[model samples]
Every structure is written in C-alpha cells, then in structure tokens.
Target: MSGRQAVPSVRGKPGWLRRLDPLTKGIWLLCTGLAVMLTLSLTAQLLWYLVVLILAGTGAGWRLKQWRLFALWAMGFGLPLLLFQWLMLPVGGDEPLWQPFGSGGPALTASALELSAALTLRSMTLFASSIVYATTTEPRDVVVALTQQLRMPDKLAYAAAVALRFVPLLLAEAEQIRRAERLRRLTPVRGVGGRLQSARRMALAIVRSALRHVQDVSTAMEAKRFGSARARTHWRRVAISPAGWLFAAASIGAAAATLVYF
Candidate 1:
C-alpha cells in the first residue's frame, strides 16, 4: 500500500435512521433485492435503485463522498456483468444494436443490451441497498435482533456479530502488513508475473494472520463460556416502534408493487 492514500471517512448527518431497527432494514434489503432479481425488469430495477438512493441520501443523510463510493462500487461490480451480458449472451433473431470495433464479429443486439441493462441494474440495486443498510445499522444491533427477535441460535448470532466486527480489524491489519513490507523496502512488482507472485505472498500472509486471529477469538470465547447459558440477557434492548414498522412496510410494499406491475 505504498503510495496508497488514507481514505477519509465521510460522516453522514445524524438522523433517525440510526435508530431504526436493524431487523427491519435487513428485511427491506432482502425483500427488495429478491424482488429485483425475480422480476429482472429493467424499469423496476432502475426505479428500485433510485428509490434506495433517495432513502440513503434523504433519510440517511448521504453526502458527496458516499455518492462517490456508491459509483465506485457500481463500476467495480456492475460494469463487468453488463459487459459480459452484452458481449457473450446469445441473441437469436434480434436486430444488432451495436458492433464491436474489429474483426466484424457477431454484433450486439437489443435483447442482449436489454438483458445486460437488467442484470447490471439488479446487481447495482442490491449493492446500493446493502451499502445503505450497513452504513445505517450497527453490528451489535443486528446481532441483538438476530438473537432476540429472530430467535437465532446464540452461537450463530455471536459468530455473525464477530465476523461483522472483524471487517475493519482485518482491513487495518492488511494495511499494517503492507506498511511493514514497505518499511522493509518491499514494493509491488511492476510486471504481470511479478505482481501475481507478490499478490500470492500477500494473500498467504493475510490468510495465515486471519486464521491465527480466529483461533485466538475462539479460545477467548470458549474460556468465557460465551454460549453456556440456556438463555442470555441482553444489556440493551432494541424495540422497533410502530413508526418504524410503517416505514419498513411502505418500502417493502413499494418494492413488491414494482415487481407486480413489471
């Protein structure tokens, strides 16, 4: 990560979104994502994506940095799917909408283009919804909701919570490893082969470190008898007010209606 710059955290304005039940947000994202995937309708997907954006921007108080992150994520994850669908998906009897620059090969068709757009939109919609949910919800709240409201197994809930909490730690560890390598005068290799070798080395180091960390966590949990109790009491209770339910219902209903109309 030499020459890699530190990313500034873009803090959103404090809002009631932080107070919303994690379970409701989870359900909304799940329902909306599934609806988009099932409908595979370009219009519905686009609309859903826009709706999620508005929710994140207005309700969650998104700013320029968040929007930039959203765009970056879309390009990274959605663009490849779109390109592959357009280039490789078969289009029988459909008129060509585009032709590649060289070799005079099979041209792209309206059907293929439409399919590509649908796939891209579906993926982007899901990704955007996840970003909104994760940014707005807290990990502890999610774990509590899973265990208390959803009646998930205590061990499973704890594991999920720990995994979510590990994300930032793992990222920071990777950065530290990179910095250490740079301190030792190690840098990214220039050529494709060298880069691949460097990547392999880095990956192995990260994986080994992660495994050690996981082992330590497991030992610590076992020592603490984390799941020994038949029933555990939470220090903090999460209650979803009537208003929260109404908000969730409206969002889910809109998504379902979109699917039905499309």
Candidate 2:
C-alpha cells in the first residue's frame, strides 16, 4: 500500500532556528494563541492572521490546504454578525444606517458595523492561527513541549499526539476505502445503497485500522524499552531560532499595544 505507514518523516530543525528550545516556540505559540482568542482589537487580529498566514507557507504543504476550508467555515460562522448587527442595532443608538424591516426594525449604525468587523476578524484570526500552529509544528512536539516545559501530565500529552496523528491517517485510509468501494460497485453514480453501505464499511475499517495501529505502537514502544519507568526520547526535535524570537516579540508587542490603546 502506498499509504501504508513505514515511519513518519517530520522535518528536522532548520539551520535558522536550531538554537532556541522547544519551550520557547511553545511559549510563542501559546501567547499568540491567547491573543487570537481574547483580543477585541481588529488591528491586533489582522497582524496575527498575517503572521500565521505567512508561516503556513513554510511547513508541510498539507496545512496550506486548510485555508480553502477555513474560508467557507469563517464565512458560515461570520454570517451571524450580519444578523446580530441587524437585531441589536437601532434600539438605543442615535446614529442609524440600515433599516431592514419597514417599521418593526432596529437601526444598523457605524458602531454596530465596527463591532461586527471586530468580532468577525477575531474569529477568523483564531481559526487561522490554530490551523497554522498545528500545520507548522508537529503534534508530538506540541505535546512534548507541554509536558516537558509546562509540566503537563505525560499521559494526557501522549494521548493528544496520538489523536492528532490518527486523524490524517484515518482520513487518508477512509478515502482509499471509499475509492475501493466505488470500484467494487459497478455504477456511474453513487446510489443510496452504495453510500450507506460504503460508509458503514469505512467506519469498521477505520476502527480496525486504529486498533491495529495502537497495538503496533505499543509493541514498538515495548521493544524500545519505553515504559512508565524509563525516559522516552523523541526522534523529531523542535528548536526555535532568532527569527522565531523576533516573531514572538513582535506578536507580544502588538498585543501589548492593542491592550494599551484599547
């Protein structure tokens, strides 16, 4: 199988960022993530989105594909802003811009548009930042940084890594199985029978594949002497560079400025 797992080939430390520890990268991601989540300022949100969008091009190409998916997602989520602006405005405000209904309506003011823009930008930044971080950094590194630097529980970290790794594998495997089913069924179109039965088969296949993977990982771990008693070493090492430090500093500075100004 072209898709069969031999081993995961995660990229190594770039010459540019080999000096800083994983903890620093982790810290930068955390702080940026917090800013993405908590900030109400539009400028800060746009800055974070732009930084992460550029960073997305640096890593595995798979992560960049999420931008397409996120556009649809963000628009779907952002639609509520229009509704909120329509419903909540004109109730008490002096300035009114949009009147949706004849007379049973509220007014849409500039303030309402500003609030909507802020909320929408914040939501989009949060979504893009999350995808960028996940795509640029390996899940294992994230878990390791949490456990080693933040004193997160070892079991929790391990579980998180496994789950993240499992998602893409399962998705790929499901795609393969779906193709196989299509081939098996001699049809120009996917009928209800084909869709339902194929979905059921894919679910079972996913479960079996997951269980097998778990068993294999356990066996390999035991063979390598990994246990509750022994220290586990990661093959993929994540280190930050001077550029990463500058990036973090800029992100923090932006957040600070936004906080001070707002």
Candidate 3:
C-alpha cells in the first residue's frame, strides 16, 4: 500500500505543502518552533503565526473546518496561560491596570499584558505549526525519509512512525470510551475529585488498549524479521524535490530574519 493509504489521519487532496518530502516539512516545523521560541516581540510572534496560517490555508488547503479545532485548542490553552501570566506572575510594572482587592491582590499592569500576549502568541504559533505538519505529513513517509535519507536506524524510525500514527488512534479510542460510558448512562463526574477519578479510569483503559495494539505490532514485526538486516530497503522512496529545497531555504531565511530582527 502507498504511504498515504497507510495513515488515515493524513487525508485530503495533496497540496503544495503535502507534496514536500517529510524531511523538508520536518525542517520547516523545527525552524518555525525555534523562531517562535527565540522571538520576544509580540508583533513578531503574531506575524509568525499569521505566516503559518497563510501557509496552511494556501499551501496545505486548510479551510475553516480545519482551523476550527485548532482555534479551539489555541484558545483553550492560550487564554488560561495569558490570564495566569497577567494575574499570578510577578513580572510587570508597578502601575496597576486593575487592582481587584485593595492595594496588593494580583493587579494587572501594562507590562504584564505585553509579556502575557507575547508568551501566549509564541505558544499558539508553535501549536498551529505542529498541527499543520502533523496533518500534512504522512507517518510512513516520515519513516522512509528518516531511515533512507537521514540514515537513522530502522527500528528507531519505525518507532517514530508508530508513535505518529497511533497518537490520533489513541485519542479516538479515548473518545469512544467516553461515548460508551455516556451511552451506558454513567453519571457525569461533578467536582474536581470525581473528574480526576473518571479521567484516571479512562486513561487506564486507553493504556491497556494501546499496550495490546503495541503487542500485536511487535509480533508482526518480529514475524517479518524486522531489524534483522544491517541494511534496510524502503517500500517507498522519498526524495527532496527542488521546491522542497527552496521551501527549506526560505524557512531558514525567515527564521534567521525573525531571530535577528525580532
């Protein structure tokens, strides 16, 4: 089967971003992550995130549907972090924007707002870039590129591929477990303690399922004599196209510019 067929998560028609070799997309992700980490300016961080969104929209064919989940995730985590930084963190100016409880109870300030915004934007950028890479790149192609082009060990490369492929499966499985519980008329967990118990039970179930699947995969690999040979042959050959090279170079240049200018 083709690499694309092996992973159902990598759906949708191929686009410019999806056509690039896994190595090239990996490099782009790495560069984007590093650039976001090194960037301190809020404006620069926002620009980087916008550039990633544009790439996802134009190159990866991402639409409102694709962005909906991403937006939810970004806001779910970003807003809390932003508020935490602004309220709890002790890294802001003395001029209080809003003193909630008299003189000294988590007063908001301009510097706090700026710092929180930058940090939140940086996190959101990394999150969005990761989603783009994971959605566009195929797990089997990642294995091929790593083992063939990067000369990584076949065992290690396959492990990485399995990780990439199983994450979504595990998530779906957890959701299914939740739905099953709901269908059985299980009472919804109320407080923090009850929620933690429910979560713990769900995690245990997922872990057990994942372990069983891993055992099956291990058995199949052993039957095939995986990692027996010093040299490995890939079913699919992955090579960097000229466009991939250009994309890598452009990403590196942009990362450099972000580091230096911002």
Could you say which candidate leads in lDDT? 3
Distance from true location, Cα of 112 in model 3, Å: 1.5
Candidate 1 local lDDT, 136-178, one digit each (tens)? 7767888899988999998888887777555545544666666
> Which pairs of residues collide in candidate 2?
17-241, 90-107
Model 3 clash pairs are none
TM-score of each: 0.79, 0.61, 0.84
What does candidate 2 score on TM?
0.61
Best by TM-score: 3
Q: Residues 1-262, candidate 3, lDDT per residue (tens digit)?
A: 2222322246765678989999999989999999989878988899998999898877775545445645766787999999988887664556888877778577888888888899989988887787678778889999999988898988889998888777656755766777677677656669989888887988999999999989999999999998888897667999899999999999999999999998
Per-residue lDDT over 9-59 for candidate 2, one digit per residue giving the tens place of the 0 to 100 score: 133224222234545555666677677667666667677777765655454
RMSD of every prediction: 4.0, 6.3, 3.9
- Could you tell me the lDDT of residue 181 within candidate 3? 70
Candidate 2: C-alpha RMSD after superposition = 6.3
Scored by Cα lDDT, where does model 2 land?
0.61
Candidate that beats the other on lDDT, 1 or 3, i.e. the better one: 3
Off by over 4 Å in 2: 1-25, 57-66, 80-92, 147-151, 166-227, 233-237
CA lDDT scores, all candidates in order: 0.74, 0.61, 0.81
Per TM-score, what order, best first? Answer: 3, 1, 2
